[model samples]
Target: MSSVLFHSLRVKAIQPDTAEAVVVSFEVPQELREVFGFTQGQYLTLRKEIEGQDLRRSYSICAGVDDGELRVGVRKVKGGVFSNWINEHLQPGDTVNVMAPQGRFFVPIEAESKRHHVGIAGGSGITPILSIMKTVLAREPASRFTLIYGNRSLRSTMFKEEIEDLKDRYMTRLVLHHVFSDEHTDAPINMGLMDRGKIEAFLGTVVPAAGIDHAYICGPFQMNDEAEAALLAAGVPEEGVHVERFGIAQPAAGAGQVGAVVHEAKPGDAEQARITIIRDGLKREIQFYKDQPSILDCASAAGLEVPFSCTSGVCGTCRAKVMEGDVRMERNFALDRHEVAAGFVLTCQAHPMTERVVLSFDER
Candidate 1:
């Protein structure tokens, strides 16, 4: 399970979306087929060494599972190292290291059913929704899909041309509405952001709120929050709205320094000291460091690989148990409070609060 072996994928192609965004398609090594199989909306964690420093980022799959080609779409953000590299420099036949597809942003589609699916995305959030929309329509012949995308302008729309083509192919079954915030059009509906009023009006006039079988949402933090609230208000069931939040962007290096004050631990106290890990029936001791890097970082540096994605703690890919020690986690956007209290830790965000910490990644 060492991550070192999974870090050798070669880049197949880099397709540009805009001046700042590029879609990097990678060839999955044949030996890692088991790890690359993915659902429609799952994402991949890409790690790379740049300027002698390791950087990690997550990008959502842009194609369906049956397509057999694993890909991710990334948008360059200001001051982002890996993203900027992919946008400006990454080319076909280059190499990039990526984790397997990982995320809880999708639901299984039944084999023989036509369903009504609605997706709301903003900016580059269309990445995962694009895959889901295509899969649902292609798999379920009678199914209908609707995508409401928001962008700053037509020039900035990530997949505007592709979406328009899908509309023509699917005829009336596939609906698309592009909301441009910083531009104007002859049609009133396309002139502004997809705000609460517009969404509510669409639900009232165009699509019935209760008729939606599934809904997918992805965007900036505020956009996601607003869209989820509007959908819930429109009578969509809580379970029907699947949200895919990008990992929270880390602030600039000097934005704020993390401070920690370690509590005292009793000597030889199992609860407060060293924790034991049983992997392949062999026991190993792991000592915790309250102020050090995450447990996953420590383990990986020690040559132990634990599968993970979005190390910013947005994806639940690195979930494991605290078999013996106490840990403190920060910014847990993926797991619920109950799971955290149930001895589960998102190892990517976990830091030792006690001396001994033990975890297992044997898939439950």
Candidate 2:
């Protein structure tokens, strides 16, 4: 559970990053500064009520650690309720509910270490990468950073001017490359979608896998995987690569809501499973059908508002511990091997494998 507590923070400012995106800054009161302190690549979850509906969405913090500010880039997408509202209506001084920063997209910064870092980001995915690059450049003065960002066009590129400013500031240490999908570039190789072949070509030339101390990739699902695969094929070790799974909101088919599913049992496997969830010192039991997607779905079916965002198992907001019986996660990208071995599972992806399962969300 990634801290279910929400704090009311006042919006400090709003700057338009692009036509479809805005950079939002929040004012953290003096007393809550410590609570809002965050790492480079973490994110903040914002909750708001719109038209009688409570909506929650997560955005990566775009400010660097040493900058001592809290900000996030919200890019409007088709049918994105919160995003559209933020870009079109949000104003300075408005109060919004925000959760503490949470994510695992950054590597530890060592001031004395001289290393080469690579970052591949696309569209608004550059939010966290911007933080990482700024922190690295500011903290580890000896390290060099390389960024290959992709977008549809210059108009759609978030943080374009800021990234350029950083390049000018650290001309010798920062390398920046932009790839546009809809716009033509002087370099023919940088004018296409950043797929596996494009990323491999960059890996082979501009950003080689050899001597890379750390690599961070965040983009659309396919592009992220493509960049990771290209780096691996180019000999980048598994541990050296850190990927943040972006674009978790799969729009609901007919409704505007996201990730809403009908709970039903599998055709042949019709046994109902008993699931006991322990949250905030309260115990609740529910009957779950095995064919359902996850325990999180079971919680939702029972009208339990479990702490979950990006129910796709990318964020660890719905992580809990399995105390009794057994559960198998359908997929996991949040928890590490050690955490999984220690009984921690992303409840969003966990499916009860036993007839009776007891899980606790209070424990880390």
Candidate 3:
């Protein structure tokens, strides 16, 4: 039987910056490396016990994967149980259960390619973008990076000093522009929100769209959408724009929370659907509830182990393939249409529409 060990990991340090924001770093145990190896823009799902219930939250990795340490920046939202708990109670050496890194929000740089990469981010959305920026800057010799970061004020921006140091080190290759929405400053370019006009103006004046090969955007849903639109309007191709949404927007009209109904059944019964889970060389078949909208939920409820970060379809962590039968997805902000047509299904958003389904997570 497969198992997920709830290892007690020590929190090496926690640095609280703004009132509701913190930068947390942890030292991973040796055995956890197999689970924690991640690409640039992946995130970790931290499972913590709060108020006698298991609360899970996804936090994007801010540090480069090669750093050999795990770190994430979390911005606490009002009344958010997990975020508030991490900011208020989490401390150095504190133990918590965290799932392995799981996401496809990043692209690897080719060794011989020279590209101009840009990132548009705000608030805690800078986390994954930071990882992607740092990784690309380090991996590519002729690559250049430019960041257009937005925040309410200077005090609210996370990793201010680190970003500045990066700018100084990269010198001509790395550029950063800060936009403060609340405070008016002496700098003429610093006074407005990153609306469509401002984003276009910034791109026109700073990094020309023609020179940029890739654009990564992460922020509020509207911000991401606007940034992509602005980029596309400025002659950037639609394929060059990659978006990572922080959270799901409000469900559209008539859309409800997706769930399932569990029922007891025999192992080989035809009515009992089969879910194939493959991770790290192990493969197993598990039963599921037919009426549910997500196999991820059913697997979690049945005590089957799977690698997942966000339960929502926003993060691609729970992505797997349907090799045999058909499945329908609820909402997908992570995968594009081509990926969906290629049999990729976000398990967190997948429900078997057919009687038999075979899926795989082991495909590279």
| TM-scores of all predicted structures | 0.84, 0.89, 0.87
lDDT of 2 by residue, 7-125 (tens): 99999999998989999999999999999999999999889998798888889999999997899999997888899999999999999999878877899999999999999998888
TM-score of model 2 (CA atoms): 0.89
Off-target runs (Cα >4 Å) in candidate 2 are 1-3, 248-293, 300-305, 333-342, 362-364
Residue 45 error, candidate 3, Å: 1.6
Candidates sorted by lDDT, descending order? 2, 3, 1
Q: Could you list the CA RMSD of all candidates, in the order they appear? A: 4.2, 3.3, 4.4
lDDT of each: 0.76, 0.87, 0.81
Overall local distance difference test of candidate 1: 0.76
Best by TM-score: 2
RMSD (CA, angstroms), candidate 2 = 3.3
Work out how many backbone clashes candidate 2 has. 0
Ranking by TM-score: 2, 3, 1
lDDT of candidate 2 at residue 259, scale 0 to 100: 45
